[model samples]
Target: MTVVVGTVCVAVSCLIQSDPVAGLFGASTFGLVSAYTALFHTPRLLALCWTAAAATLTVLTVRWAGHDLAFVVSSALLVALVVVFVTFAGRMTIWLLDADIFHPNLDALTGLLNHDGFHEKAATLLTSSSRTDDRFFVVAVVNLDSYSLLRSLAGTIGVDRARIEVARRLRDTARSNAVLAHPSDSEFVIADLFTEPDTSPLIERVQGTINAASARLTASIGVVCTPLAPVAKLPAPDVIDELMAVASNAMYNARRAGGNRVTYVNDPALTVLDAPPTDEWPDDDTR
Candidate 1:
């Protein structure tokens, strides 16, 4: 869209201006706008390609409008100036945006991706993967069942240490393809997708890891996976939410049943869709 609009503007300029330099002025303006837009939204190599294409078009328009060689060279120089200026401006703006927006994606406690970072990576993976390849997600909610009791008995420091240990166990258990995030103090949410591989072994491994962490702590696990049986496709955001809800429901069930178990539900509709199990967490822990 940016390229098309800029090309059209350059064409109009060629038609209205008799002088080569004047004809180039319009292309220069278009280049400046395009450079800014591309810098904000496009990769460096791609932006360079766009600038080169625009410069070529500017030269053509000047020649087509019957300008002298000196005038054409001068117009070409203008395009170069636009490229240099835009490149520097775009680089600076992108750096600022990255620093401000992306730096906070990691969790401070666990050194894992936080909620925003998890969402960002999940969206990217969901968009890139195709349903044709049996691509799907296994959204897992792993919570320390004994967190409240541990906090009561050992105080804040002990609970923090236990949380960090649990997070480390989970990260170790998850495969390289998985994305792990610490969304809450006691709960560590993990997303397994992209590879469309079996999650059973990994789930079992994670459960075992947490169970062996400490006798005082046990993890309640839940998962939601896709391409189960009937549903081959689902909207990205809807699927994410539904899976989270179902996994959450299973985790709640696990917590209700004494807390040291792994549970998963592929079909969310079969599960109770009422208000999330109120019995799941204490009031202070509401996200």
Candidate 2:
């Protein structure tokens, strides 16, 4: 929209001035404005098209204003240089902005989203998924059951190494598009585990990654799925907190039974506790 306005304004200025000097000045102004505007807001194709059109228009303006061949050549060269400047400056600005946004959300050690960042980014993803035919999403938290034991054996340095290794493995084991978060030392959460099938294999794969990290390391994951049962209809960001808690409870249940297992819980009411076992509760209706 701004591009359209800028382009139209430049053409009008060129037409009204009807002088060679005015034409050259207008071309320069247009080039700078378009470049900056495109950098901030316009699409790549739009920028490309605008650059071509502006160059052509500049030559035409010079010729229309009765300028000599030398002036026309100069105008074209100036316009091209302006375009190049815009491209370089715009790219640098974009890179800096992205770094600023990403640095805040990332966990320094694992380079995964911190708890707050995970919720923010994952919510955006879910909103996108909501627009599609997909009816369900999965949230799973992988907890290292042997974290304390690993620390006891490996010490702080060894523990950090193990965590880095585990974080990498977790990143690899999940689907390419999965949103992963590191909320605490021993906990890693995954969102957009979108497949609706039984989550057992998924859990097993996560556990396997941790076990592979070290002989002393094993993990239990708690997963809670939403809107799969007729009674469940979970909403965005708000529902995420509830689901995480329910999944955490299920994870604890797995911890209780012994570690290195997967537990799936569907808590429609998002209950902290008092969630019936999977076999006993068919739906999320909680009192």
Cα lDDT of model 2 by residue, 20-106, tens digit: 566555555655655566566657645654654565566665565454777667666776677567766777787677767658898
List, residue by residue over 1-287, the lDDT tens digit for candidate 1: 66556646655665467665555555556546555666655565446456555655555654655546676666676766785577577777877787667677987777788877887776565666654666556788988886778899989888888888888888788877678888888888888663454577878888888878863577898887765222323344555666778888889988898888878776456322333444664688565
Clashing pairs for model 1 are: none
**Candidate 2 runs further than 4 Å off:** 1-102, 228-235, 267-287
Candidate 1 local distance difference test against the native = 0.69
Q: Rate the local accuracy (lDDT) of all candidates.
A: 0.69, 0.71
Error of 1 at 55 (Å): 62
Scored against the true structure, residue 103 in model 1 reaches a CA lDDT of 72
**TM-score of model 2 (CA atoms):** 0.55
Cα deviation of 40, candidate 2, in Å: 24
Using all chains and alpha carbons, the TM-scores for the candidates as numbered come to 0.54, 0.55
